[model samples]
Target chain A: MKTPTIRDVAQRAKVSLKTVSRVINNEPSVRANTRERVQRAIETLGYLPDLSARSLRSATSYALGVVYDNPNAYYVISVQNGVLSACREQGFGLQIHPCDSSSPRLAEELRDLVRRSRLAGLVVAPPMSERMELVRYLAANKIPFVRILSAAEDPADGYPCVYVDDRDAAYEITEHLIQLGHQRIGFLWGGVSHRSSPERFKGYESALKDYGIPLDKKLVIPGDYSFDDGFRGARRLFALRDRPTAIFGSNDEIAAGVLAAAKSCGIDVPYELSIAGFEDSPFSKQSWPALTTAKQNTEEIARHAALRLIAELRPPGDAIAAAYAKNEGFSPQLVIRDSTARARLPAAD
Target chain B: MKTPTIRDVAQRAKVSLKTVSRVINNEPSVRANTRERVQRAIETLGYLPDLSARSLRSATSYALGVVYDNPNAYYVISVQNGVLSACREQGFGLQIHPCDSSSPRLAEELRDLVRRSRLAGLVVAPPMSERMELVRYLAANKIPFVRILSAAEDPADGYPCVYVDDRDAAYEITEHLIQLGHQRIGFLWGGVSHRSSPERFKGYESALKDYGIPLDKKLVIPGDYSFDDGFRGARRLFALRDRPTAIFGSNDEIAAGVLAAAKSCGIDVPYELSIAGFEDSPFSKQSWPALTTAKQNTEEIARHAALRLIAELRPPGDAIAAAYAKNEGFSPQLVIRDSTARARLPAAD
Candidate 1:
């Protein structure tokens, strides 16, 4: 059997070849109903647009790139799925590039990736999104990109970005613990390279200050966002003469680690001790005592970023730009789970 | 700055344009040292082969597709990394297509995906790889694809495939439990759709037969490869009047579920009851009593599959085919952890 072509798709859809081409190109002139018909016909007939053949006559690319350097598999997968969803809907191919954000050649490598692949745009996720130099390079090079970042407000860095209010979400989680009468709440920080780390810490601090509880430096433990880090941090806190009654890990991975550490020390979760984590990743639910976490909806955030980048890539239009501007912010919500509970009296502790 | 061209790479590497083209095409005619020099020059000058431009004059595609339908995030990510590493090295772009294996339109969707993207070949992972119809379609259509599958021996499908010996690994795990004096051991199975499920079960049965342990239908539980299934399966096993002293889950996720169920039931792991899981996934390590599992290096398997596909895609040569044939088989090793221990005395039960 011969591979289906655009002409076959047009014939199947009962439309002219030019109309099918317009729909494939995403021309505004094509009506929505007709576009749907052509799409269905294309799917039914298994017709491919021959992007390489099309690119010969035009410079427009149908591929989108996702650039990130995070070690968390769950987070990366979620972001990739979100972006891929958007790309699929828009008939654009996704090019995933997992690169070292700290590498001196990052800018050059990214430039090479874009030029070689002819990417229509990029969806940048942290901590690559937080890199000022990379951001500047993309902007200076006129690369269409949307950044997924942790910020209280849009930085207006001359590029579209999706802002995640990590600080606010962290504050809510910390407040939940404080309200439960956890005065000596210990804090575990993620890697400093991630902008969310500082934002989350700020929220935890602000919550403590709001409750008139003086910050105790001894109760704070610094560690990267990992299970081992959480384990080590918890061990250090547990070793102190006056151990913290409650602990907050920067992410679900760390929080799960804390749970493991507590179990090893024979500390009953939410009874003798309380633990919470940020980013309601799979680890939170899989943990023995499901972690109380902030539901960041990373997938949705990534989807929005991809959509925003696609919108930016579209031909200059006021409606598209307005939609992108309005969808720039996202805030995670606190979700109470089994890992946290009311603090026990000092004597009981 | 103008995007670097193949001419620039050839000039920088002090090679003729024909030599550079041969190297880029992965022609066996190019010497190893010359290939390295051309690669370095390409990288140094950020020269993109302009796949679209090149394809206009030839039938070769610059993109490879990964077709899969797996719920395991870790598995998917590992496979993607493996394939992407191969793609990056060969200067090929990766196009990920996550599809439902059971969907009636799967074949059509995949055919469309290949045609639209002009994918050079596909690196297919199970359970999609297990579908005979899909495999037949790809072969009939002359679409190059390499399958990552679980089988005791090569299926001789005429298509290049990478096989993992799940049966032997499962037998080893069951034998490990048997050596620890476990008599009444329960078995948990993964979804029937997966070829590994039956292969693993066969191993377990063979091990039991070797030890003169009669097969007890009551001790076996059927389930999909998931945490919830593991939990439910363990619960069912524990409900039996004469409960098994040990349980073996088909995968780490299932084993982690078993651990969770055991914890909830207040059963002391490896003391009152022992548990083992297959696939040394992250869940195994993160589980409270880390699981004893089979270390099937999925990433390595995927990498080999990608390399095989790339080799097959190259201009036909005996050397490439021989390498592909030699690298087709893989065996997983058993890793014992905290989850398994000697069975307690019958009097204790």
Candidate 2:
């Protein structure tokens, strides 16, 4: 079958070619009823408007790319969904690019992608967003993009970003445990490359210092953000002659591993040991006894990042653009579940 | 910074306009040395070839869309990764579209998307792929597409699809349990809309019939593909006076829930009760006792679907197209883990 054309749409709608064109371009000259008829006719005939012609006239590509290098499937999906929602609302197309952040040619690859795709802008996700050098490269190249990064405050480098305060959230989580009488707490670190890991560690340290509890070097274990890492880290802690009362997993996956490890060792969670996780993911709720963690609104953060990028592309003074111009920041709030409780006093010596 | 044009690339490579064009078009007439020089210059200058001009001359859009309506983040991410890999190899841009299959205007929405985006083709994921009405509409409209679905055998409706043999895989799983000397086994169903649920149910029933065990209607609990549902269903089964010694969750998420439930109920898995799950997702291994499941190569299946779609878009008699012309089918293989074991003979009453 031959592809349907704008002329076919015009003929089917019983309107002139110019009127159909006006409706396709979203020109306000067309009456509402006429525009509806044209849209119905277009859908019925499945008429494809010439994108090349439209792009040339507008001098802008109606699409954006989202670049990320993350292993967490849930986080990636949430980011995609958020960006998709923004694109859908604005009548723009979205392209998801999952890349290896460790690649030496990362900048070159991104430049090539931006040039070849003719993308209007980009939403760069962490840990790529945390790399100041890459961010500077993008800025120097005049590539329009927004960064979603973990930071206590803006870097003040003139680069637009949506930041999450992992340090503050971590501090709050630690404080919660401290209040629950957990003096000797074990901390499991996330991936080192991500700025969030260090930021969270700092928060944990500050809380310990404030509580006048000596931070134990042995209690802090280095591991990536994964279930296996959490399990291994927990096992290491469990093997110690004097184990901590509470274990804090940087993320939910890690915490879940800790829970599984505790179970394997016949240690009752919240009774014999307390396990806490970050990121209130779906499984966090489904886990037996549930997990107490921080509720980071990843989808919302990603949505704001895309919106900020789009705002930069739009003309200044545009209503939506102006609304999104201000940089956004988020602080994950602690969600108390059954994972944590008062630390039991040591058995009578 | 000024956007570099093709002329700039040609000048940098010390080549004429025609030579640069040939290199950009990937014509065989261009020498390898010349192509390499042109490519390096293009990358260094960050030149963007006029996609509209190239698309117009060739009459092809270098973009495709992957449409899905799945709740599983892992499954969705795998599909996206697979499609992205194919698109990367084929020099095509990919758009990810997550839509509601239950929408009444799903067909109209898809038609508008295809028309507006001018996509070369679409990779449709289930349960949208399972809807014959929508599939027929695309076929009738001459919209190029490939579907990924679950079936015992190809429907052979002429429409190209990649089918997973859920029935066969389920049959193997059930047989494994029956061989373990389990007479009364509980079954959990996935979403009713997805054909896999019924297909898997049929396989389970056949396995029971073959083993000369009567189907206990009360033992089969109707539930969707979710951890909550699995937990609820398991709780109900445990409440029964005559509880089954073995349980088969339709998918890994369900099985995970069952594992959690068993822990809550103080039931010893694979000792007093046995559990098995389908789909070897990451969590299955992370679960306390690793699950025995059917390993479905979702990424591979999705990749084949995209390759087949791209093949359809390529010119006839093309070598790559020829390789992907044949319809693909898959049977998930059973993976034995700690979740299952020989059921001990019931204690003498």
Query: Against the true structure, whose DockQ is highest?
Result: 1
lDDT, candidate 2, A176-204, per-residue tens: 99999888899999999999999999989
C-alpha lDDT of residue B289 in model 1? 72
User: Candidates' lDDT values, in order?
Assistant: 0.88, 0.89
Number of clashing pairs per prediction, in order:
0, 0
What pairs collide in candidate 1? Answer: none
Candidate 1, residues B88-206, lDDT tens digits: the string is: 87777898888889999888788778887788999999999999998998888888899999999988868779999999999999999999999999999999999999999999999
* Residue A231 error, candidate 1, Å: 0.7
lDDT of 2 at B199: 93
For residues A176-201, could you state the per-residue lDDT of candidate 1 as single tens digits?
A: 99999899999999999999999999
Candidate 2 lDDT over B1-349, as tens digits, reads 6778888998999999889988887789888888999999988987878665566556688888999998998899989888888988988888888999999999878876876777788999999999999999998878899999999898788999999999999999999999999998999999998989999999999999999999999999999999999999999999899999999999999998898899889898878788999989887877777889999989999999999999999888998789998788999999999989998877742
Over 4 Å off in model 2, which ranges?
A: A1-52, B7-19, B28-48
